[model samples]
Target: MSKEYLDGIIRRSLEIRNKYHELERLHHGSEWTVEEDALAYLTDAGLVGRNIMSQQQRWPKAGSQTELEHKLGENIWWLIVLAKRSGIDIKDAVNNFLTETEAILK
Candidate 1:
């Protein structure tokens, strides 16, 4: 992706993180650390996995694909937030990983 696209993602992710923090402060009287946020999103990703399996089996309680998509987006947002908090440039990190993987494959 272009740098513009990555920057937009980072901007939107930070907006989402701020909004969530505000809501969390109102509901729980505190915001969680980046580590906690990451863990929570990871747990949500697991739920998405369960939903996928249930849908595959045609189970009654299975969540819709839209729900899974939303959860996946949330997971990405959480990752961006964590990276920001940890002083890492998410775009650079992703690019480095892709480059390393491609070199390994070659």
Candidate 2:
């Protein structure tokens, strides 16, 4: 995707996250901690593994394609959100990783 499209996605994700934080503050008297966000991201990451197992026919219960797709998107969203919260630029981090890995392989 173009950087503009990716940035738009990130912007929208942050907006939604902020809205949720507002609801959380209203109900709980505070927003979620970064640790809590990490926990949530880990939970969804586990779901991604479970979905993969189901797809491989190793899981007892079949995973819905819709659920898997949603989880995948959520995982990426969580990563982007987490990076922003940690004061890291997600785009730059990704680019650096790619460049380094490519160089290593060469």
Candidate 3:
């Protein structure tokens, strides 16, 4: 995708995150800590695994594909948010990962 498209996606993701932070501040008197975000991300990551198990018929869940799709997207969002919180440039990080991995594979 074009950088412009990716920027739009990131903008939307951050906007959603801002709303969640606002809600958290109202409920908890503070935004969630980075550790809390990490925990939430891990929870979703576990659900992703569960969905994979269901997809493979190893789990008894009735709906896996849709939830899997959602979790996968949610994971990406979490990564983006985590990177922002940690002062990383997400686009550069992704680019470096892909480039280095592809070079190593080749």
Candidate 4:
């Protein structure tokens, strides 16, 4: 992806994270720790996986496709959130991963 696209994603993720933190503060009175955020990311990922499985099996309920798409977006948002919380630049990490994997394949 282009730098602009990646930067846009990062900027949007920060906005979402701020909004989510505010919501959490209203309900829970505090921001979550890095570990808690990581757990939330994993939970969302698992829900996405389950939804994918349901779709593949043709056993999806009403609006399952929409729910799947929503969850996929949530999963990506949480990934960026977790990366930020852990002080990692997700774009750089992804680029490094691609480079390493390509080198291994070569």
Per-prediction count of colliding residue pairs?
A: 0, 0, 0, 0
List the candidates' TM-scores in order. 0.83, 0.95, 0.95, 0.90
Tens-digit lDDT track of model 1 for 2-104? 7899899999999988998999999999998877887897898897787677667755564567786887787888788988989999888988999999999
Candidate scoring better on TM-score of 1 and 4: 4
Winner on lDDT between 1 and 4 is 4
Put down candidate 2 lDDT per residue, 1-106, tens digits, no spaces.
9989999999988988999899999999999999999999999999998888887778866555778899999999999989999999999999999999999999
Would you list the C-alpha lDDT of every candidate in the order shown? 0.84, 0.92, 0.95, 0.87
Best candidate per lDDT, number? 3
**What clash pairs does model 4 have?**
none
* CA displacement after TM-score superposition, residue 21 of candidate 2 (Å): 0.3
Query: Which portions of model 2 miss their true places by more than 4 Å?
Result: none
What residue runs in model 1 are displaced by over 4 Å at the alpha carbon?
Answer: 58-60
Cand. 4 Cα-lDDT: 0.87
Question: Which is better, 3 or 4, measured by lDDT?
Answer: 3
Comparing candidate 2 with candidate 4, which one achieves the higher TM-score? 2
Q: State the lDDT at 41 in candidate 2.
A: 99
lDDT score for candidate 1 against the true structure: 0.84
- Candidate 1: RMSD to truth: 2.0
* Error of model 4, residue 18, in angstroms: 0.8
